[model samples]
Target: MNDLTINTAIQTALPATFLGRHLIDGNWVEGAETFQRVSPSHDTVVSVSAKGDAAVTADAIAAARKAFDAGVWSRISAKERSAVLLKVADLIEANVERIAVQETLESGKPISQALGEVAGAADLWRYAASLARTSHGDSHNSLGADMLGVVVKDPIGVVSIITPWNFPFWILSQKLPFALAAGCTVVVKPSEMTPSSTVMMGELLIEAGLPAGVCNIVLGHGEPVGSVMSTHADVDMVTFTGSTAVGKMITEASAGTLKKVALELGGKNPQVIMPDADLENAADAATFGIYFNVGQCCNSSSRIIVHESIAEGFVARVVALSRKVKFGDPMDPDTQVGAIVTAEHQTKIDGYVKEAVAAGAKLELGGGALSVEGLGPQFYQPTVISNVTPDMPIAREEVFGPVLTVLTFKTLEEAIALTNDSEYGLSAGIWSNDIHTCLEYARHAKAGTVWTNTWMDGYPELAFGGVKQSGQGREIGRYGYDEFLEVKSLVMRVGRDSRKPWVKASA
Candidate 1:
């Protein structure tokens, strides 16, 4: 690793020259146009990224298709592919600091959190590597003595992956590594707002011996680039992580080609605090759920559904805890909350809070924009709102920021009702000591992932996804790998006297 130190003063340490290139067909190529990437913390241009148009996106798709059809990557042995993925994981571990710094600079997440996400990304790669070697087909002995039957899992060809701005590298790891492990070629489009880290990822994959045309990166807005990737006939699968609205768009666009789509979209996750629960611990868990990653996570517990008996005290505890959260320079290791992704996003979060307050939700704490000493006005104070009704927009919609809305439930049935009442069924949590109550609620909640006494806990071995409008299909674990694969069954006659009476009967 180079002994390059990032300047803590300006927070602009990345090389200006490494920015405006797209990785296509295993080569760094300049784009037809370029756009400046402004840091959310300081509002300064951090890098100029390549702007991929429809034609450029088509080129990337063609490259991936060629690689897949050529069988350069798809026909390779599973163990060999696993070896390559393991090397990629090794490379990522070696450059954790560098990648984390770039991620923090581009996405405005705290440096400590960024480092943790980078390490998580490396672990995801290693897990995908393990899956690659272990994944296998099946043979049936029950087919009878005259015939043999086999079922095989094969790669689904070129995959187009679109990742979001928040947790850029981490989300990409959830999709890309597994796709590659399954022997699929890929064309990726990271969010234009934070493409720097992903662009560097393309370089790192190449260094780790990913074959040319096997992995391609296109940097641009969703307009021509994302649209092309979704509708392109050559692309076999599209896995996206972002808003539910955009996930719907991708699904509609993919209808033209009937491509396989796995969408990990938005959420209005609820944290239900039962009357028997520990108020202090529940408050702390709620704070972590809605504030971590600046509450930009899809599975963020934005809604706090508390039993009426404990609602008031729990709300007060959450408000007091919100005050202790530090918001400042993203590069600082002590900063718990960092700047929002952009001024536009900050405005949207503010608008939600304002609308909620106007609609009779009481603002218990932090309700407006925050001004850090030297950082620009992109940070918003961690906010807590109480007296939120189920019908209120703040309670129903996704705020996508460090804003938590508190609602009270009179009974266990009411709590479960409130939890299931959403267009999103991504994630939900129950804070209770009663095993039977927790289990009942978990079974009834409409979410894909339910945490009994925890929030946002995940493992690569377990499947993750959402139900209803939260989008379709699963990610991570064997399910995530299966998303990039297709199953095929084969049958063959084995008996020497297998030429039976079919022709005689026809005659």
Candidate 2:
């Protein structure tokens, strides 16, 4: 692209605005308070949004409940629903550059990754549109001459979605499209830090012809807005993506109403490097696994469990890769690593590093805090720590930053034990040349997802989620739609006569 094109692409066509207010009943209304979105790279206020509290969040829940139960949006055919979603996808694609820039400025992610996420999110919408028609229920053959049995899936009505700041558009796309495809009305509570894109998404959905209230955006903190949405009596389901602590809170809040809850929480995933693995490939994979998106990913491989034979070599290679990573100017396409989300989060990450060091963990590469040259107070620089024990805070805690801890094991059993030591069971990666070892780890690893010979990869077709503390329920596949749906089993009497008398219960 030319210089003019490059400059123009990075700038948003839409004028910068406060974007304050929650989108309820098809219009924006200010809440009692407001929250500021600060640029993590430069520590400057980027935008602000109305801090939706319990009352305002209740309004959104009521609107979604009304849309699902009374409005025409949920009454449409699957094909018609798919058409609307496809339109939303198209509109997002048309404004990809603008949305990408907005996301980068707010979330402190690299502009290239942000653009890719925007495109990927748009594709997710289109994919869900196609899946709408494909995911109908199934019928079973009657066991006897007089009976017919079928299993049907139905939308669970109003859904409350609470998303995180990292990959703002992508996380929403993951939940919202599937919920829409399932014929459910949605109320989204985006992270206070990156609420701008979601608010803009409201306008795009409107332009895409989605009926008002079919999809709504509420901006605010988790305590009030998120808690209210999770506990709202009218909301039939709640889905959240964030830390384990917050995920637990959502589950607790939703318990009173018995809302269906789907959580994608934190992870302390392990990257196992076997003795026979390609050192170069493993090193590169390990680096990208932890450092990509500044290690803010739930499935990031923060723990490197390597065989003792190759520990030093692998650590050296990882340290080399860490040093070479470009960390600055999130808007630059060449920037391989970007800033952490905020100063508070950066401090938290640095604390983890310090605590780990105090606990006898060796800082192999970048450790401590770093401020980008041009940027004011960004958390840049890739970090890699070796000689780390499982007991170290950095090894166990989800720092949610670009910090990696390396540990060594002599035997496969030890490695497996170490990998399963964490409370999280989100995802793990095993790098090995041996087919048996790959299959063994894949079979025995205590994680929701496992990658053999690869790391930190995902697709729309594959399901994503966790098993233990990483959270419950799945997203991004058929399970994603299933999470938003309630299933009913239909059973009919096989014989008209009194041959088989059975007591039946009503659902």
Candidate 3:
């Protein structure tokens, strides 16, 4: 179907009844309390979602634990698990339009972007399903004729998955599918700001024939639910994607039980453009990297460190492109830049811009909140601040909005230095024609993933994660499956006589 038809169908068939409940133990359970979900695109109530507290969180954890220990899912063969995951991927693709609509309404991302996210999520699930069958361990052939050593990867057990509001379904797909592929039962806590899509996925899991308690969805604030998920002894692992501050808190909570923790945290990613770079392509990529998803992505290239020779021209091109971005209703397929996820986030974005301008950074483009006649007040204009230094808070901190800061460097060494100076090492990009320069930066950049002449490129086959304070552990590809698995070595002796005489020699 065409885009317009799909959008119209979604609006007409809004699934409001799907809200206000938690999926636990293969049942839709009501929460003790409910919270109204306000759409940032229109400032209207989209739906009411269950606000899971400690009791509800505990129930979900118990369910996951039971599922895992009972071997209802954990004992399934790799082929069986792969089939289920493939079915889930198919279900996601079938409901792409509806998923995209719900995601856009909840997260205030443009409908087009939401569609792309849904597609990416489906791809991730399929990739994970393939990995489920191919994930294999090693055999030690050099153990000699009398001994055999075999290493096998087994499911870690119940996993607690915490996802962020921005790219909600996409991030959940990244973690949940891989964990399930590895035979791990999961208790998912989607960001309360955007929980409807995940709750709907609970239904999809049921339809996909996932066993009871194999996956549970709990929606609520971070305090009680998240605390329980991270600290609960039944949870074998916690996979989180959000702010670094919250990631640290989860890490501390998980320390009590010593549960495995996989975090994909925040980033103030840098995009370096050398003198020989294609100015137009670099500007385009930089603009998309920062403004896409309203710059809420952890790997958003917010920092553009250009060589002095081409700094002014590149900044001018980016500013011109930024001004052209359409800021309007997220539901509109044509919208390029949508609303911030919340009013508070809009304020935060504006505050960062104001602080930067006050601190002497020149505002070359938008620097304030945008108010469309029919849309809500959550929209923030695509902003560009020039002449920023590395020491400035705007340059160092993650704004999590459609805000870009421009800085200049004289040498390649200085560019690498500026990129690695931040505590975060999530992702970065380099725009240069010279292969040597690209290779040098790719090797030295502290970020987990670096793109040459491109920005924000990702694939399911690639391993994505951060380094340093950006967080630990990897997600996607075989490594993502490894996160949910525990390796055990089995050693056996065949055709050997047992003898123990070391202690008897003295006697």
The number of the candidate with the highest lDDT is 1
lDDT of 3 at 353: 91
| Residue-level lDDT tens digits of model 2 in 56-163 | 788888888888888467778999999999999989989898888878888888888898999888878888898898987878784667767889888889999899
Model 1, runs deviating above 4 Å = 1-18, 505-507
**lDDT values, one for every candidate:** 0.89, 0.83, 0.88
Q: Tens-digit lDDT track for model 1 on 1-507?
A: 011111233343543534758999999989778998788886678878889999999999999999999999999999889999999899898888988887887888888999999988888999999999999899998977888889999999999999999988999999999999999999999999889888878878998899999999999999999999999999999999999999999999999889999999989999999988977788899999999998888989999999898888888888777777767788888777888998888899999999989999898888888767667778888889998988989999998999999999988899999999999999999999999999999999999999989888899998899999898999999988899999999988886755657657554
Model 1 TM-score on a 0 to 1 scale: 0.96
Query: lDDT of model 1 at residue 255?
Result: 98
State the displacement of the C-alpha of residue 470, model 2, in Å, after optimal TM-score superposition: 0.3
Q: Each candidate: how many clashes?
A: 0, 0, 0
Give residue 417's lDDT in candidate 2 (0 to 100): 92
What ordering of candidates by lDDT runs from best to worst? Answer: 1, 3, 2
lDDT of 3: 0.88
- Per-residue CA lDDT of model 3 for 427-481, tens digit only, reads 9999989999999999999988999998888999999999988999999988877
TM-score of 2: 0.93
